[model samples]
Target: MAAKTEDLTELSNIISTNVKNYLSHVPTPPTLRPTPPVPVTDEVAAEAREQLLLACRRVISLVGGPIETVMGMSAAFHQTTAMKLAYDMKLAHNVPLDGSPIALGELAAKTGASEETIVRVMRALTLQDVFVETAPGYFAHTSGSAVIGIPGIEALIGHWTDESFASAPHISDALRENNFQPPEDSRKLAFNRAFDTNKNFFEYAYTEDKPMGARFSQAMTAAGTARGPYNLVAVYEPLRAAPKGTTLVDIGGGIGHVAIAAAQKFPNLNCVVQDIGMVVSEGRDGLPEELKDRVEFQENDFFKGQPIGGPGVYYYLRHILHDHPDPWVSLSRPISWEKGDSLGGILSHIASVMDSSSRILIDEDIMNEHMGPEGNKMTITLDFQMLVMCNGKERTEAQWAALLKSADERLVIEKVWRAKRNDSGIIEARLA
Candidate 1:
């Protein structure tokens, strides 16, 4: 009892300090409304807010007791189910944005869902503060529910709750089938198994379920835009000093926005954005007239040897490597990677094309060795999401080192420009 009391006091202290720090910087108490995630002008305030939120979670877990914690975890799926139903019924749009609440029956009529169903779902959401009960039987939007109004957010929610959620339960079964490999092939994983499809997740998304395909694409865009740490600012210093006339090949870069930005930032350097045929066409067509001369969109697969090669060239891969299984080099001994298997095929191709003066810059989340709730909720969830949907696995710093060394004995991680706020970083590799 004494130890428990001490732990509770420590948690309370943390919460009190962080709350004061946040208020000192912002001078405003947060309300149940949407606002910018971070105070744009104040990094200190942003850090404080993050700390405060983390401390609150810790406090909740500490006080809630083991039974309550486990029960909440077990029933967490109820929230997702409610959210998905709400989304399908277009609940966000149904709710009046003018701070007026709609009665249960009226909301059901508008959304074409049953009043009974709406009542139960709203109850689940309201307890979570997604929506609030303005009166005895009326509902109003809160910050949590209001986010569904954002562009692409609905698709993201739908993708996760529908296809992704369905696949997750079968993960253990897929693991058993694959003998518990850290990462199994996409065809053998939970996604393919759940959907009864022989094609990979991407193929199934695009072909089998067109709506899901569209949702996945939009969700990816939404996610890409949200990762502030992975942007060009993270590694601008090194990129600024590159030779005036060098080629930067963005392998598997989609739609070429990053390549376009790179070309605009560094006028003297040429940029080549490479992807599949459809993506290359879209990127080429979208190129601004000013960057036409410096930026080229080419259709090429990374698994095959790099089509463009030479000295003084830089190969850029953003969020590309984490899509495949890892430890391409066998832990037992040095061995060549199988064709089209893991990062081995991809890395070997890049290694074969690189000259002594060339470099491979991979922009990815460099995960920690251990997944701690205080530090990492996003990356750990993402790692599992990748496992279920595809054969991908996020690599830690040590895992990256072994994989790179296996690709080529000469290849070395020259430097890593880690983001200040997150695991996102630029791993710069060069031939030793």
Candidate 2:
């Protein structure tokens, strides 16, 4: 056998060639929407983008200096912090959208921020390709900065900057105080420690202030925007396959997004969106007139017993489980688990009501088995966010399987449908 070797330069060259070739084959994306610059509409383009991005990252790491690399890692939070400040100051909104530039002093006056502060923050973002300095002292919106001014995206920025940022500092404290244990109660998590409150994030945001609750809802909508059409409904094939008039129970469904989507896609599939009393009421009112006949809203706490039960129905929970802490005990056979408290109790109740034909659909991000250098970054980041806010976590495939088995031995994993060009999956479970 011939001894073959590759140097860093050669590796970089190969990666660069691969990236260029991949990009060359794909159609060029527009600079802005309604013709979105993101190649999200095309599956092949999306996959190509993934490959190109990984290659580019590899090339950068292989060529970059160790000191500079470490410095960039250390200063990673600065970009987010500056972006947050930009959002806070409404810099994106103040900047001209028609390619004309706003002088630093004028922009500062509009935002009520100092000219010097505005210059520093704008310059920082400009370097990152967020905004652009067309002239020596004037700034204008780039494709990146323009989107943040939208109500939904701005709300998302506010939620992350104001709510999530507040909790970041307390994660270490919460971990240290609990002896590095995941706190059992959500109230004892990093968010509570940061604000010195007993209420959970949702409770604080929803009950304490109505406007904040509304913004949180908008923020969630905005957060999902990047995913485009690669949604839970698209991933869950059972909905399309089900017979007409099949009922889907969406438990803990906030504002009934999934149910609405399902009802719209599968006209014959009736949906019952269940959540807390307040959310249910809001959902009921917020539902479109066309969907009103197909989709209905109900008030029900999932921790309590199953509210509705029947054969051939699908109970859907999208992005719900990760907000809950790990199970404390098994639910197989019979156990002294209290109702209206934990997921085990809820699962047991659901199992008791489920027939062999019925299925429970969990649509969530199941973490990769081995989180490598090229692993999904959003899932990992969200896992920590869950940890800090609720002592919850994004579970791996094995963890999900184990959880289902532990919840109820009869609750077998029927299938896991992971979507192409997306990390989200639909895990369908049924009674054995």
Tens-digit lDDT track for model 1 on 1-432?
112333767767877887788778775666676443332235676777667667777777778878999999998887888888887889988998655788988998899999999998888888888889988989988777777767677778888889988898898988886578744445668898789987668667766776776577667656766665335544646677878778999887877877877888878789999986666776788899998889998888665558888898889988787876653222221222233433336777888879989998888888888545555677777888888888787788888888888888888898888766666788889999
Q: Candidate 1, clashing residue pairs?
A: none
Give Cα distance to truth, residue 5, candidate 2, Å. 11
- Model 1 segments beyond 4 Å from truth? 1-6, 26-29, 34-41, 182-184, 207-210, 285-289, 327-344
Against the true structure, candidate 2 reaches a TM-score of 0.90
Clash count per candidate? 0, 0
Instruction: List model 2 lDDT by residue over 158-234, tens digit each.
Output: 87788788898789888888798876677788898777777777777777766878888877766765666535567
Worst 10 residues of 1 by lDDT: 328-337
TM-scores, all models, native as reference? 0.88, 0.90
